[model samples]
Target: MSFLLGHFNYLIVVFLMMGGLWITFSSRNYIKRMIGLALFQTSVGLFYISLGKVAGGTAAIVLDKTSKAGEALNAHLSPDYVARAGVDGVVYSNPLPHVLILTAIVVGVATLAVGLAIAVRVREAYGTVEAGEIAELDRTEAGPRA
Candidate 1:
């Protein structure tokens, strides 16, 4: 069940990415294009999140779990205890992906805002929000200008 859940998360990310790509290419409306851009950015975020997660492993911070009530806890947790725990003395999961995702999220929002702004401008100038109309108007204008 857990494996499926893990894979499902990544699969959904891929699905979202493909949906966004399809929308981005298939839409004629500026708004729809912007929606697709936003979806694509969100999908990328999902990808990063999916890549960063570690199954069954807690965050890397060593939470002073050493018990003070008994010396046995200290004895067991000595250097030997770390060696027995397994590879590299700790199963520390890489956090770089998480950090990068945080930055990417901020950048994604900015990109969406910029895209929407351009879409609004396109709609204003062309008197229509459709990509087809905007392209048509641009072509007509260019034909005369040249």
Candidate 2:
């Protein structure tokens, strides 16, 4: 249907989110879980980027009033459009989502690095990266503590 076609990006986002969550929950390997977490983060970023887009919109850049291009733009715009926009008829896309996503990407990478480092340490300490194995090792080490 038209509705489904129109919202294809959202469908992809949802799919990625569910797949990531499934992988994160179902996997026993620390590295696999980290990958799933990264996938989920990427889907979130993509969703934000999709939300920030506007139909027939350009970048939200202000043109110099004195420039020829600005003058031409103003001349081509209708009075009502100029009145509404306070300048020209150009529709600008919101940049806030993109900026926030950039920040999230940096934080995600740092978090992934820390997670991988911890996994490496766990592997060295427990001789395995599987959650079940690690837990078993811990329980055996504890020796049925009261």
Candidate 3:
């Protein structure tokens, strides 16, 4: 298990995505479907975060001048040691995915709110939120199609 442990986040991502998909597809209630869509959106965000992570990585903060000076002193002591240290320098995880995910989350919430609002309107108009019932009502109201 080290490999399994290392990649566990991906498994959770898949589970969440699949669960969301199931709810969205199988639920008769529009609200439940919207909740599933939100769940799916969350899973997508998690997936992006997981993919953007770097093992043993830190934030992409710039090193201060003092730290750079200390590193220079250490480098002069031993070239080989400095070479190794340089190779193992602070690894930074990518920030773009996290930023994009933040934007996506805002968009997802807005979309969910709009969807719920529409669902509310639909319920008011049709007296129910079940898609099948709404379709039946529509058919009855429309009569036979030529």
Cα lDDT tens digits, model 3, 1-146, are 99999889999999999999999999999999999999999999999999988654445564432476445544434545434443344345678898999999998999999999999988888888899988897878742232
Cα lDDT for residue 135, candidate 1? 73
Query: Worst 10-residue stretch by lDDT in candidate 2?
Result: 137-146
Top candidate, metric lDDT? 2
The 10 consecutive residues of candidate 1 with the worst lDDT sum are 65-74
TM-score of each: 0.69, 0.78, 0.76
Better of 1 and 2 by lDDT: 2
lDDT score, candidate 1, position 3: 95
lDDT of 3: 0.79
Write one digit per residue (lDDT tens) for candidate 1, span 1-146: 98987599888888999999999899988789878988888888878877876543335554343444233433445566545542344433457777887898898889888888886776666677886766777778542121
Candidate 1 root-mean-square deviation in Å: 5.8
RMSD of each: 5.8, 4.5, 6.0
Model 3 misses residue 74 by how many Å? 15
TM-score of 2: 0.78
Question: What is the descending lDDT order?
Answer: 2, 3, 1
Candidate 2 residue lDDT tens string, 29-140: 9999999999999999999999988654556687664577656655655656655655355545678998899999999999999999998888877778899977897778
